[model samples]
Target: MDTNQIVRAVKTPVTLVLLAVLVYFAANWGLDAVRKPIPPRPPEPCVVQQIGPELTPDHVYVRVYNGSKTNGLAKRLGSVLSADGFKVVKRVNADRDDYPRSLVVGHSEDSPEVALVRKALTNVDFMADGRIDRTVDVIIGSEQPGAAEQPDLKVPLPDGTACLPKIQTVEVNE
Candidate 1:
């Protein structure tokens, strides 16, 4: 073969070999990056949600807090609230532990979600804190209230539009 023919034949193979090596290395690097471990994500606290006229226990989002000296009171009440069909997203100790009576705190005392929770417990009173988010905080005081028997789970909102806490995956940790 002539010199040009030999050079063309050698150049094609060399070019192909270099291209194959480049592609293989790039693929391996990409896969390694993809396989790297991803850190766990923290849970979101709460979000305001708008719902229809009727409010049910399932639609009500709650965070139970222990304001009493009793240990695990928040966790126990959270479970009871969950069993009653309320979406209990969090259970934690309150900032204070000297509450004399359990209180339900919400954006407004007239909120449907607050009213439903208030009806489900005994010896509880409503306290409006004007929180923007519609999450109803149930603070268990030294005199914790017992769940009402056959409490009404569904109630219609007199107002056309109602804002409540967006239901999230349950996080029953203290």
Candidate 2:
């Protein structure tokens, strides 16, 4: 047999094998890309509070009430509480829509969860109810501090505590 004929015969099979390999890889790559699952989207970041507590947030079932007219204030506060580990069961509007100050009211004075809820929110008042349920009611008032569209209450200082220096009248030569 001629050498050129042998070479030509060998090249056909070799080229066919290479083409097969290339086609195999291309099909696999395309199928893998289509079959591969897309990574799930990450959840929204929670603003968890750093208040260490004897009890976890799940221990307290909080019911948030928007005592003020501020839209979504109770919901926002509820989200903060939920992020902090508190068990926020409900968010609703108060029966009376007029509230001057926010309050954290427990089911009873002996209720143990009020303190934990209050600890998350330092600048609010608290109350005790006579009901026999395990729930904490957070009434968000118009003056609720640390919320948007309103400022926190200013702290009262003792006399001479102002940063400005006192001025005294001085006699000057004309």
Scored by lDDT, the top model is 1
lDDT by residue for model 1 over 1-174, one digit each (tens)? 999999998998999999999999999999999999997764344454456667888878899999999999999999999999998988999999999999999878787878889888888878998766678899999889899998877778766456654444567988
- In model 2, residue pairs whose N, Cα or C atoms come closer than 3 Å (at least 3 residues apart or on different chains), thus clashing, are 57-85, 57-86
Q: Where is model 1 more than 4 Å wrong at Cα?
A: 1-53, 166-174
Question: Worst lDDT window (10 residues) for model 2?
Answer: 160-169
Clashes of 2: 2
Q: Pick the candidate with the highest TM-score.
A: 1
The C-alpha RMSD in Å for every predicted model, in order, reads 10.4, 18.1
TM-score of each: 0.65, 0.51
Lowest summed lDDT window (length 10), candidate 1: 41-50
Question: How well does model 2 score by local distance difference test?
Answer: 0.67
Per-residue lDDT tens digits of candidate 2, residues 80-137? 8887777777898999778999998875544446655766775678788643455678
**In model 2, which runs have C-alpha deviations exceeding 4 angstroms?**
1-53, 145-174
